[model samples]
Structure formats: C-alpha cells, structure tokens
Target chain A: MAYTAEKPVPPPSSDELRARIPGWGADLDPADRPSFPRESLDLRPEGAHWDFPERQEPDGPRERSVEHKFLTPVFGTAQPLTGISGVIRRYAYDRFSEGRAAHWLLLIAGDRVDAIESHLKSFATFRPDNPITETGLMAEVKRHPIRSRFGRGRADLRHTWIDPILVAGPWVLTGWLVLKVLRPKR
Target chain B: MRAMTYRGPYKVRVEEKDMPKIEHPNDAIVRVDLASICGSDLHLYHGLMTDLRIGHTFGHEFIGTVHEVGPSVQNLKVGDRVMVPFNIYCGSCFFCARGLYSNCHNVNANATAVGGIYGYSHTTGGYDGGQAEFVRVPFADVGPTIIPEWMDPEDALMLTDAFSTGYFGAQIGDIHEGDTVVVFGAGPVGLAAARSSWLMGAGRVIVIDHLDYRLEKAREFAFAETYNFNEYDDIVVHMKKITGFLGADVAIEAVGAEADGNLLQHITAAKLKMQGGSPVALNWAIDSVRKGATVSVIGAYGPIFNAVKFGDAVNKGLTLRMNQAPVKRQWPRLFEHIKNGYIKPSDMITHRIPLEHIAEGYHMFSSKLDDCIKTVVVPNAS
Candidate 1:
C-alpha cells in the first residue's frame, strides 16, 4: 500500500475544507485526520491571514494581532516598545474547557523579548491571586478582536482602538501607548 | 564458571563468580536452559552505563526450566518450562495497579530507575541475569512464564523482550487496521516491531535498516517490506516515493541508540526530539504520520533531564504516547496468541549454546556476527 496523500479511510468532512478554502493548494491538508491549515495554526509565517484579512472586497475587521508591545522602565525611564507583536504561541491547558489545548501567538518582538518573558514567568510562578497581573494584560489583548489595524481597510480595523499612528511609531512610543491604555478587553 | 560480567571499557568478563540464590519467598531457581543477549545490555558492555558495579551479570532474554522454588511458589513446580519476561514486578504498586508492571515499586524500587529487570544494567535493576548455568528468579510466579510442553524452546525464548519490546513499539506506532507502518532499524527490536505491526493489522509494513541480515530476517519473519537505508541517498524521499509521496501512517524507532553521547549520552536527544525540538529521526517518524497521526514510542530512553518544547507536536496536531511496555499487562494475550499459532515470533532465533558457553554467544550476538538475530543458552541439556 502506498502513502496516499489521501487517507485510505478519508474523513467525510474533508471536502468541506477544500470547498471552504477555494484556490488553496490541494496539499493544504496536512497528514492525519481533521487537520487544519498551517496558515491557521502558525500566525508568524502565515499571520497575515490569521484574523479577518485586509478587505480587497466587501469586508469588515482587518486582520489584527493578539501580540502586544510590552515595556518596562529601567532606572525610572520607561523602556522602548518591544514584544512579539503577533503574540508568542504555546499550549495552554484549560481544565474548565475539559481538555488540553494550544494557545497560539504572533510573537513580534522589538528588543527585550527576554525581559518580557521573565516578567511573564515571574508573575506566572510567583503571584498569589494568579498570573493575571502579568499575563492578564497580554492575554486580554490577544483575545480582543482586531483592536489594532493594518493594511487597506478601516472596516478591517473597525471598532479596534489601534490608532494607525501607533502601528507606525518607534518601539518606545508604541510600548508607551499600549501600556498607557491599560484598558481591560472587557 | 565464567560469567558475562561488566568490568570496564569494552570489558564484559566471563569471570569466575558465585551462583545466585532465591532471595525472595516468591523466588525460584532456574537452571537456564536458554538465554539471549540484548541490545540494551550493550550499554553495560561498552561501559556507557558505569554504575553496574564490577562483575554484574548481564542478559535478559531467556527460557529456562525451574529447578527449585521457594516455599511460597504456587504457580509452577520444579521442571516446569518457562521464559522470563525481561522485567520483574511484584504485581502490586501504584505502577502495577495502573498496569505498568515493569515499573513495579515493591519488586524493583531499590534496583533501577523504572523497575528491575535481569541482565540489563544498574540503571534498570542490578539483578543478576540468566546468562549463566543457573539464575535466581525473583517474583518467580510473575516473572517466569510457563511455556507449553510441546513448543520448541527456540520458538519460545524470544517471547521475553525483543518480541515484546518490538510489539510494544508497534503498538506505540498505532498500526491500526489497514494502516501502513514504516519501522526504523531492523535490529531485533525493530524486527519485532515490524512483526507486531503486521499482526496489529497494518496493510503494509516497511522495515528500514542499513544491514542485510536484519532486512532479510525482517521479511522472512516479520512479513515487512524492507528498505535498505544504504540503497538510497535520501531515505525520507525514498520512503515517500514508495508510499506514493504521502508517507506511512506510522513509523517506529527501535534502534535505541543514545548516539548523542558516548555509551550513555542520556537520551536528551530523544527527549529533546520528543519536544518537537530536536533533530530529524523522531521528527521524521512524526512527520510520516498522516496529519493528526499518533506516534507511540516503546524504545527505552534515559532522561534528557531538561526542558522540552512540545510546540511542534501540538501545532502538528500529533498525539504521541510512549512508555516501557508493561509486559505483564500483555502477557495473557501474547501467550494466547502463541498458543493458537497466531504469532510465530520466536522463529527468529538463530543460535543456541550451553549456559557455560554463553560468553561466546553474547559476543556473537552483540557483534551481529553471522547474522545472529537471537541466541539462546542451555545449562543441563545433553
């Protein structure tokens, strides 16, 4: 028996995927059952489409990143804006949800990826009421819908508080701005 | 009598030593009618596993006749034929209750890391092994399997480790009904994995190896299509071509080499590989799975003792399950399969010598000299 890119016992709904992603390459279906497109899972190399894409046609909500700019002041001067903007990806088990699951990110960093990681780690392992003091901000930002905008459409960034100016500014200013909002997604 | 004892670098001695005795109440003394060397035991031979102390007895694969039994022995009387599964378990422990008998705490809590087994190493269990004229079998009722009276010892001897290990490997590979399995390395364990793959209902089984003897024996016994790694410049590409470019639904890595370091490099490579973080072998096997495929590993591994990046596995949506085979859990079915002639896994044995001549058999088997697949030793046989 040969390795049919097609499974011998093909899933009944595989055709749904083919139909849904028109003109997408046939090889798009990864091995194994019920596979999603790599573009959907990895937001880095394929992040451009993880959210609603830039409107080339009638559309709303431009693709936005869950990643945020994190900054910490050294010697009382707030550090420059830096972080993996797309969000750093990882698996986060949700016991309440009833199964182990993967939490993904875009992870676009500016300079101190390491510092941001340490701060997150410290809060995760050391905090008393939970890690929300650290991760809550980032996690909330990640869950917020297209709060920032990029590319061609206002509808894409529609409702997102991400002002166009912030997207284009230097690392320091962006980090300062994101921190200043301090608004919870809720 | 000379014994296969671990000494130093490249030094396994056929040394003079005192014979072992039944130390536990459930113990039995077996006059080893047959025994075989194992690949894992080579770790001691090469001095990679430096903790076995001096003069440690080695060799886990064996078939013996019970010569004596302690007062508590009830399952079998003297003269009953038996094959000792590589590991010994007390049948009661947190691990045992979970059916992971190989990691039994009562029987092996003090000896090795997971649990105790014979002839493997200090890290496994420092127990004396059956590669001798006589061996002491602990937890005899659980460790010694009674072979039917009529079956050939050669055919029953391998029922211990290689077959079980390979079977476990195939089980890990998840060779489901009609699935195509690609097994890496055709050493004894790999051959066994291939054999088990076929028995597990795989539509096609492919065994990969650079060796000619193993490839041949794999086909003759395991019923696998063989791929000689030497024949192709690109093993993965060749494999894909054979599979029509999709890849096998499952792949098993049975070579069990800790190549990352000398003798025992601490299978950090394998551990790292598991994280979807390291090199190609594991990743290749993992990649071979049709998307969302499951990969199980039964290959024994040392602790990588570090962080693991499981992101790749998660992203690929692959589910991997691995553990040392709790042989006791599978013993009933495996024995039944043997009884019904459904599995002729023991036919791979190629050499048999008296217990006194075990040193030579070990050398031959270890060297893979003359295409030796499995070798056994007998003590009292004419």
Candidate 2:
C-alpha cells in the first residue's frame, strides 16, 4: 500500500467543537470540558507515511469532575507543585467551602433559596478550560442575600475558631513591636 | 540515517531519516548497537494503542554506545556503552524520588497516563525509540546505566525492559520461601517472570499459555510446570483443581490487552476497543489465585477503562500490586543474578536481523513464524 505523510489540520472554532462533540464530563456543558492547545508541530517519524487523517484535536485534559477527582486533571501543561507552599495552597483550594452559605445554619428560607439559585446561575457561562475562573462564580454565590446572615464578607477566609487570628498573630506582633520600638524614644 | 517507521497497522518500513540531535540538556544521543522487539510492541503493530501517528518508530528495548552527551548529562560520557531503562524519568520528581520511575512526573507532556517511553507511540512521550541508527536518551544520568564489562550486550539489552519487567512481576508478588506462584502467558516477559520466580523462593511455578512451543520453553528455561490452556475446558478451573481448590498463593499477569479467551470478550475488548484489552488473563488470575493472595501485573495495558473484576478481588481480599516496572530499581539485583548464572535473558532470542529487515522481523514475530520467540535488530549491520 502506498503511504504519504499527512500534515495535521487546524483546530476548529470553539463553536464547531462544541457542536460536534457532546459534553464529556458529569456536568453536561461544553464549557466544563477541559481544552487542549492547538497542534503546532509535526513530530511524525521521518520517511514514515500513511494515509490516516491527522488527529483533528489533541486529547482533552484528563477527566477531573467530582466523581473523577481521583484521576489526574491533565491540562495542556503539567502542573508542578512550586514547593511546600504550593502543596498547602492546593490543599486550601480543594477544601475551600466557607464562601458558600451552606456553612451557615440560621439563614432565612428565602435567602437560602437565593444562594442556591445564584450558584446554578453561575454555571450558565462556566468555561472548563479556565477552571480557576469557576472560583469567581463561587465567589458570586458567596454574595447571595442568605450568606449575609452569617455576618462575614463573601471573601472571608475559610478558618475554624481562632485560626485566622492565630495566623495573623505573628504579623500583628511584628506591627506592634515596630510601633513600640519606633515610638518617640522619650 | 535509516530508521524504521510505522506506516499503519501491520505496516512498517526502513527509510532514510535525519539523525536525531540533543533536544534537551540532559539528552545523550546513543548509536544503537542492538535493540529487541518486545511483545508489548505488538499493541502498536495491531493498532491497539491510540495516537500512534504514521511515521512513528516503535521500540523501547534497546542498548547502545553513547555517540554524544549534552552538557548536563552527568554520569555518562561520549563512547560509553549504556543500557537505558524503558521509562524516561527525571530523577527528582516526587514519583521518581520514591522510585516510581515509570510514573515520573516530568518528561512526558501527557504524563497523566504514562511516563515517557521511547518510540512506543505519541501517548508514551513521543520520544523516538532506538530501533534505528540512534536514539536520544533523556535524563541520561537517571535512566541509563553503564554496561558492566563482564555483562553480555544482548543481556544488557534485555535488561532495558523485558527482563527487568519480568523480574519486577515476581518481586511484587511478595513470594514467601515456599509460595506457589502461577504466571500467565509464556512470552518473553512471562518466561522471564517464571524464571525469576524460582529465584524468589517460589516452591512451585506454573506458566500458562496456549502456544505449545512457548510452554515448552517455559518448562525448559524457567524449570517450571507448564499448562496449555487450549487443552483444558476451563483453564482457571484446572488451575484451582491443581492447587487443591484453594488456588495458587500468587498469580502474575504477564499478558496485557489482546489476551484471547472468551470470544465475546475478545470482540468487545480487543477488536471493538470497547473496553481495555480483554481482561481474559486478569480475570483468570483473580479466579485462580487463593483468597487474599497477591496478583502482580506487569503486562502493559491502556490508560483507559478496563472491565476488571474489581468486585471479585475486593470480596476475595486480594492485593493487586501493579505498575509499569520501575526498570532502574531492579538493575542491581538483576546484575547480581546475571553474574551468578541464575537467569540468562538472552537465551530467548531466536532471530537476529539487521534494522533494514526489522519489518520482516516484526511480521515473523507477530505471525509466530518459525516458532519465533524473540528477534533482535542490528542498526549498523552490513
């Protein structure tokens, strides 16, 4: 059989992709699926030729929905932890819940329903490729009328008991020490 | 330079190609002295693997002399003979630091499924394999080891993948002093695993396969009992009866995807690509091993879903320990075993052909012609 080297075709527009391919993750929205970078280089072995069509798109990011969380959420790039701090940051990101009104027990009935409605509304424009942006939507949910009953700002850090104060202690002490030391040396 | 390139399923050709150069600081270009066709390469040959673009090379088992070394390649120098492990790994990754080299975090841009493997396919980091005049070895210090003066180069070639992976299969079995170990498949990996089982203090080692010739080799080379599954009505039932119905102490699956048993399963899994390679051998392993026994899998399977008998395994309280063999970790002990004459991995080599004729070699091996067990390709042959 005759063989010929094939160049990869350009990726389709986002509309074309979403129309042709159905939703892949648990949430059936085109924006919830991870996207890949366009194919730019031809790395096929030299002198190798075949009539097969080049892949239209690179493989999608690994599935990382709630049910598939155990699987790696591979993106176009591998995410390396920057250091111990990165690990702590990832842990915080995974367990972030205080911004939602579910934590508050005394919200009025109408306020609780509004919080849920706001969260559902955010999914209307959710984009999977930019998953970090979903946090912004969640932030909107945190601002619902029901969350106001808890007397905390929408961006309040998720801390239990005096942990936030404890975290602030060192900086607070440093500030006080600086004031005392720099005060008019009378 | 002439290199073997894949055109399509069951199609490969040796064509003039540009020589590879250093693409990374840790890269070392090696003039391939010898390379072998592994059984797992058949997945690409049969078009089972995804993303195997045309013109891609298909090889992972190779040995060569260093032609050039990049600035950061610390342990290796020019002209040193080295045996590279199959997995391309960065030494400092979290997985590599824990000795899980096959799952190295760096190297492969798509490492969520597999770490870098030379020339297997684009899914395996897309690095061109050594089935040519040369191969680019990445992370040279961490993955490739210098060949000891006393070791045979062919032996060193086997150490790169097949032998090391086979020994790992036995190692993960956690064999006791007198454990009964059963190995599935009698291919190169299976044969190596069966042979290694004896060294692991296995009281009884049984190898199962449908091929009479391979089973015969298993008995002669591994010094173990062999069973041809075709002769028995139910292979697993026979294994259970032989092991006093309590099942063998441990079962090793050396046959990955493409295992043939249960015709319907073969259709859906192997032919249709509905599930991962037919879970024939793995299901047999689960059914044949004793409750709470260990099942060590070294066979190569796709990263996608497989219809494995996880519920059966869980109910039986079986421990399934599996990974792509961390090839470097087995080197020191394998070197000792080789020196002591406990295992001779090169004995399985049945044909040695030049790289130009590798397509024919692949065809013969894939077709099982002339009872071919292994075929080595020489890139520099006249």
Candidate 3:
C-alpha cells in the first residue's frame, strides 16, 4: 500500500490570511492576523464532533491549609512534559510525611526553563481558548516562574549550586580560573 | 395510482393509493420512473423498524422525472430525470451548514433531535416512500438531480442513497492521500466504501465479509484484500498481516448485526488492545482509527442510542464522525467525479429489475438468497 507521511504542509502565513478576511480597517496591524472564527474560514475540522469518553476534568489546585518545615510547596502547570491544556491534567504528587496536607509542589530547575520540569499539563479549570487569565491562584502559578527567576528582588539560584560544583572537582577549578583571568578589573 | 405497501414480514403488496400532490412551495411532484430496495429497507421487512403502520410505502431509493414544481423552485423544471437521496435536508442547520446534509434537522425530523428519514419509522419523520407511482418531493430544488442524457438508468439510480451513503462513508473514513484502509463488510455500502477509499487515494483496501460470493466479487475488483471471517476464527490477524503489523490505520465496519452478537460479550471482557473493533461501526469509530487517526462512519447505527467506549477513544486521540450520507451536499462533487472517470461507483450494482417484479427482487436481495448485491427497480408501468 501507499505510505502515510505524518508531516503537515505549512498553510498560508498569518500575513496572507489578513489579506483575505480582515477586520473592518486597513492598518489593523500584524497582531490582528489569524483572528477568525470557526464558521468564517474553510478550516479542516480536526477533532471529533462528539466528545471523547471518560470526560476527564482535572481537579484544580487544592489550597494549602498546612505548612511543613522540610517540605516546600511547589505549584506549577499540570504536566511538565506535555502541552498545558488537555481533557486530562496530571500533577506529580510530591513525597510527603504523616498527614499529607499539601497540593501543588513547585520545583525549581535550570533558570533558563520557561516552565517547571514537573510535567506541565493545564489545570483542568484552565483552557487554552478561554484561558484562566493572569489572576487568582491559576495566574499566580504562571507569575512564580517569571518573578522568582528575574525580577526586582530575584534570588540567585545559580549562586546556590555554584559553590557545590566548585568543591566537586579539578575541572571546576580550571573553569573558575579561566573565567577569573578573563574578568575586567572594576 | 399504484403504490407498493408493506403487507407483512417479508411481504409487500402493490396496491392503489392516491397520487401524491405537492403541498409546499419548495415541493415538487415526481412521477417515479425508478426506485430500489435498500439494505435498510430490509430492516423494516425483517421487522427491525416495526412501528410502521399499514400502507407504509416500502422503498426510499428512487430516481424519477419531475412532474410538478412549486413557484419557489428555481434549479429544476418538469420532465427532468433525477435521483432522490433518501435523506431530505434543509440547507440550514448545524449538520447541513457543515455539509453533513444527511443528518439535517429540519428535513429528516422524525420528531426527535437528530431527525427522521423517509419510510423508516413513525419515529423517523413519517415521510412516505418513493416505491409508488407518484411521490411528493420536499426541497425540490435541492433534492433532485438532472440525470445526464448519456448515463444509464442503472448508474443514475445508484446516486439516490446507497451509493451516496457508501461514498460518504468512504469519504468520512479518512483514507487520506496514501494509506491502507480496511473495510469490514463487502456488501453494497461496504463496496462503495472501498471504492470511495480508492478514490481518496488509498494504497490498499482490505475488505472483510463472510459470504464467499461477495468476497470473491470484492477480490475480483481488488476491493482491497478480502477476508472470509467465517473461515478464519480471528479476522484481525489477517487484517493486521495485510497492514504490515501496525493494524490498519482505518477500518470500516459496515456490517452492523452481520458480525456476531455473542462476540460483543467476549469483547467487553477483553482488553481494548485485543478488542480491535467497535461493537457498532457508527459509534466505535474510535476503535478503528490509528492513534490520532480518523474514522468516518456512514453506516446506519440504530433505532435508539448506544454508549461509546470513551476511555479508549480519548486515550488514542481518535476522531469519530457519523450520521447519514451527505448526499445532497456532495451531489455537485459526486456528479463531477462520476462525469469524469475519477470514480466508477455504479460498478457495484449486480441486479436490475423493473417495478412490476420488485417484490421478487426485494425477496432475492433482502434474503441475500440469490446473492443480489444491489437491485435497481425501474417502473414498467410507464
């Protein structure tokens, strides 16, 4: 039989679409591109007209009524590995002791990461279409990533792990020396 | 006027009935020149559609000359030969607007949500059948097709519904550019589904059915590869073998109750991986599609609703589409495709009989006794 290639052909660019069904004005700008309704365009209806079974709606983040000394609270988007929005949302239940009294466990990782490594799936309450806006407990989840990493009173996460790497080896010593030599005197 | 009325189980009487008159502005009175028995019509003959009262006209598949047209009619005129799709449709509706005309709300309204079909049941909008001397057509401008002069009545008669439904089923099955599609039945709709798949550029079509006669016919046409489910205990083994071990990307379950009733019990107990099927073809579309694949089911599902396996369907990311044929909606494209050599759908017809002996034709077809594939009924009374 013939082979099925999964690669999708790129459709027209956003600029090209604007030329077709534009809003009432000319200089409506590039941001206005791709803003159209389902009925307005000849789009291929991808999903099933019928909803999938199971009807999974991931429960929202349970508020933390308790505080523990060793355990830190980690709150982030649902799944870290997949897209943030889907019918099913899964969050990693963190390791806890005694009466397990916490929901979202926020994990800090390499500062360059846009989202936590905890496998980000969308909170069931949040949808891609009608997104849970930048407010409430849901919005707080997003801001934590930006604020903790790069803001007015940001903590240097790099510094915390740097000393350990320095003590761990001869290769680390060579790296520190090379950087120190390259540094300009202030 | 002579009308073929349902007499009893497996019996119909050609008796006199008043000639139909156009009641609506969009209505057209058609003097039926040809009509045929559908596999679904057997559902009534066998008593599946039991609630039908006396004098129920027995056929829906028809093609005829328009005798009268209302003032609002624009596209058609009297004396034009036309094929009437079984499912009447309103140009507007969620189903029609999206091109799923067979499931139109206003047209097929049987006093329910999804709507009714002609000659099916009282539950299905009690529209009369075309298996009569004269029948009234609703939405005349959109309903009838002007049969091409060169085309044979045999080919034109098929466009009515069976061919269109099968074609629609094939279109919905998501055959895509180059892919292997497996069809479960080798009956009329199944064959059309196979042909439809080929037209969509399917690399190989694997058709499954028990009857050696139908299967041999399928094999002759290379209507995909054929599998005799009666011979083999496991249909899926041979099905997968043909698809290069990945299981077919698309599987068409056109055989409704023809498969097995007891198997349903075993399937429910077994795991989804071993199941390899949807109990009902129309509903279990998720079962046939490859993960993140598509399943278009045009086969008749039921007189009542049935539940679908959602857990497996969703986890696999299957896309399911069902309902009646998009006959009117696809008419223009279907006409173009047939007018060209792009699709030869009429090749499935195995029998052609005049209206007078339609009873015997129905008996041969409905009983599947003489191996009648599709019997086209022409009016000899004319």
Candidate 4:
C-alpha cells in the first residue's frame, strides 16, 4: 500500500538523526553549501492553490519504499509486480531504504532473474531468441574482429575473453540438463 | 478526462482523471490533440529515474488546442492550436533571460541542475505531462507557440522536443564547414542530429547503432552513412581508421543511459544502478573524435556520477557541449527549415496509437517492436 493523500509521516528530527548517524546533516547549515546563495526559494511565487494536489486513484497494489510515509500522490502502474522477481523487488522496497546498497543490489538481482524468465518465456514462442543473430555473433565474422580487438585501446578488451562463456555457457548448460532429463535412465 | 498513468516500470495505462485547471495567472489548460513518446521517456519507463511517483502521467512533447487561459494570460486565446516545449520555465528567470529556458531556476524546485520538465519526474519539478486529454501548462505565455497554419500537426509535435533538440544538438557542436561528424544512436534524436549535421556544414555524417532497422532509417531519413555497431569489433577504432586515422571532427552522443554496446557497462549502470547511466556511447564519442574535435551530448541522463572518460577528453582538447535543448529557442530556425522542406519531422513517425492503447504503445516502443522509430498518441481519436 502506498501513495495516500495524507501528509507523509514527518522525518526524524535533525537532533535524533545527528545522534543516530555519524556526520548526519553536515550540509544542513546554509553557510556550508556553496549554492545556498543562488538556491533561494523567495524567487518564485507560490502558484498552487491546493494544500496538496488531488491524488490519482491507484488501480492496484504499488511498491513503495518503507522509508517514505506513503507513495507519492501519483505512481506508475505499467509493470505490475509478479513472479519471483516481483517478490524480490517487493522485498527490496519493503525492507530497505533507497540509500542502502543492498536495496539496489537486490533490484539488480531481480532484473537478472527477470531476464532469465524472459528467455524461458521466449522458448515457448514461435520466434524464440536466436543466439547467433540476436547475440551479434554473425557480425564478428563479417566485421573486422581481430583488427578491432587486438592493439585497439578498447576498455572492454579486459573482459572480452569471458564474454562468450558468460553469454553462451547458460544455453549450453541448459541444453545438457534437458538432454540428461530426457534420456532414458537405464 | 483520460490520461496515460504510470503504474510501475514498463507499465502504463489510460486512466480516468480529472480535467486540468489553470492554477496560475499564466497557466493555460490545453486539450491535447497529439502527444509523443520521446526516446528519453524510456529512462523513466525502465524505472531508472529517482522520485518518479506512481500514477504520474508521462508525456512532454505535445500539440493541442488551447482549452482555457488564466486571467493574466494575454498571448493566447481559447481554441488556439499550440505546441508546448518540454521545458516549463518562467520568462523572467535569469536563465530564461539568457535563452537558457531548459535551466530556468524559477519553475523547478531542483533548479540547481535542470528546469521543470512536464511529466519527467519529481527531480524535474514533478509537473504532470501532456499525455492526457487536457494538460495544465504553467508559464504558458512563454513556452507554447501557436502552431503555424502550414505546418503538419505531427511536425509541430516533433518540434516540441525531438526535432528541436536534434537541431540544437548540432548547433552546439560548433561545427565548421566540411567537418566530418559522427553521431551515436539512431533513435529519433540521433537521426535528427545526423540530419542537422548536414545543415551545420558537416561534409560527412556517419550514424552508428546496433539495430539494422534504425541504421536503415538513418540512411533513408538523414541521408547519412550508417554503421551497425555490432558489425565492428571496436566501433571507435573503426571510426578512427575511416577518418584517415584522425577521428571524426565532431561526435554527437545521442544515445543516453540505456546504450547497449558493452555488456559490463550496461549491466553495472542500467541494471546494477552503479552509475547514473551507461557511458558507453559517450565514451565512444569521446574516443572517436579528433584531437581538437567537439562532442555534443543532447542525451538525457539522471543526475549522478557516471564513469565518463574525463581524462581522455582533457588530453584530446575536446570541447564537450551539452544541455537540455531550449526547444522554443530553436523554433524560429526549425520552422523555416520545415517550411522550406529542408526537414520533415513527421517522416520518422511509424506508429499512431489511440490513447486507450497507450500501454501497448509503451511496450512496443520500449521493446523496439515492429521497428517503432516513433509512436504518437492520439488522445481523442475514436
């Protein structure tokens, strides 16, 4: 549940934050900031008449970080949470604040899981993902493969050797597993 | 009224919403006729942006009939067909006074970086976008221009962001006569940049993209030489070799955050959120330019640290110019180009979807399905 019209729960007081975290609100003093002079709020007149904007009604459940009191009045509904990846995303948002590396790492893991799910789903479709064409393997032969890689000041050269293994290894492993499962266990 | 609402990443729907009303003396309510999905909107769609609220309507490039005008509004009247620039800014702002409307301080609360952008995110002032039946436009007198009678509505829509930004991308490059230019990404902005390079006196323009379809579009639309980045082991090296081992005179990094060339960079930046955006194209732009060349970056990126090759740029003496295009600033020149048949902004549009089917539209564009170069939303289409 997220994005209520009610005012978000007030953030912890500066004193409390200062006590809890080291070097908290170090830039809170306007004097400490370089842009403080130019970042004046008095320049623009307050335009909005409402105390808070009219909230758009949510169609379904939306993921909100635990740190926020509620979701912003407006939220996206394009990609609804589903599958294991969704659960991982929900857990990341529900448990961790945006500041934590764990939160972002979990979301990244979720994206990988989602990629695998997409590949699996593609197998059921007529135009399954083509490893050769889609992976740009054909281009290696047609294009100058050796000349472009060797002696070139390419940053990606360090990981170039591992790319094929990382890309094709999963498919090869999946094929072996399928063969093992389908073979008659005599 | 119905509006395109963001449910989550890669998710959007047309939802019933209240009609927008004038909130400021300069505010105007526009009845949207045509709205577009910009290439940069994909960053928001992929959930890469911070503080993007749920149920936020996502649109910025739009042309519509003026429905209502506030008391202080004098430039426009009801029923006036106008195209709104993506940047929302007060005319009197110091930035606006210098023609830097995109960096206006008065409109967006986060005035330190960018000005207010319609439907971008809370980071850009959280202004609801124009992908609705009606959109409330602030600073209406300054941003919106009456659609020229001879201009196609679709062309007017493109001027709102894509075409203007592309033209601006080339303008800022400080391109000299007969200079060789290289543009990265073959998205609408990239194509527009390539097309504009010729206008800026570029002798040779080459566009790079992994997509063959987009490469074909670049050749056909921009009349620029196209190369599929996939067809090279190292595209930057190839670029140098082709340009007599000196590199292009100017390189435009039109591809932003979600560029797909280096797997590690893509995974770390786009997936892991390690950096603000994948700097693959930008790095390539820097690497593939001549020693004293210029690199124009008009691509949208989240405000954060990216692993850009700043040291290389310093060594090469590259003049890096970038900004959110002041759309209205380029309107006068672009209008002339469009009028003289020098550029057809609508020629790039490949799909037109009804507002109800906007969810499908987002999916199609995000996935690059059906070679969707551009998709326009007809909000009131039956």
Best candidate, TM-score-wise?
Answer: 4
| Poorest stretch of ten by lDDT in candidate 1 chain B | B259-268
**Interface RMSD of predicted model 2:** 28.5
**What DockQ results for candidate 1?**
0.01
- The candidate maximizing lDDT is 4
- Tens digit per residue, CA lDDT, model 2, B258-295: 78666666666655556657788999999999888999
Stretches of candidate 3 exceeding 4 Å from the true structure: A1-186, B93-95, B257-289, B305-311
Against the unseen true structure, what C-alpha lDDT does each candidate score?
0.53, 0.66, 0.52, 0.74
Measured over the true interface residues after superposition, the C-alpha RMSD of each candidate is 29.2, 28.5, 30.2, 18.2
User: For candidate 1, what is the lDDT?
Assistant: 0.53
User: Where does candidate 1 stray beyond 4 Å?
Assistant: A1-5, A8-186, B110-113, B258-283, B304-311, B355-359, B380-382
C-alpha displacement of B249 in model 2, angstroms?
A: 0.7
Clash pairs of candidate 2? A31-A128
| Per-residue lDDT of A12 in model 1 | 22
lDDT of 3 by residue, B8-75 (tens): 33445565677776555667888888787877776555333423443467667888888999766777
lDDT of 1 by residue, A74-144 (tens): 00000111234212211111111111112211111111242334334445653322222211132233322
Q: A118 in model 3: Cα distance from truth in Å?
A: 70
- Stronger candidate by DockQ (1 vs 4): 4
TM-score of B chain for each model?
A: 0.86, 0.98, 0.87, 0.99
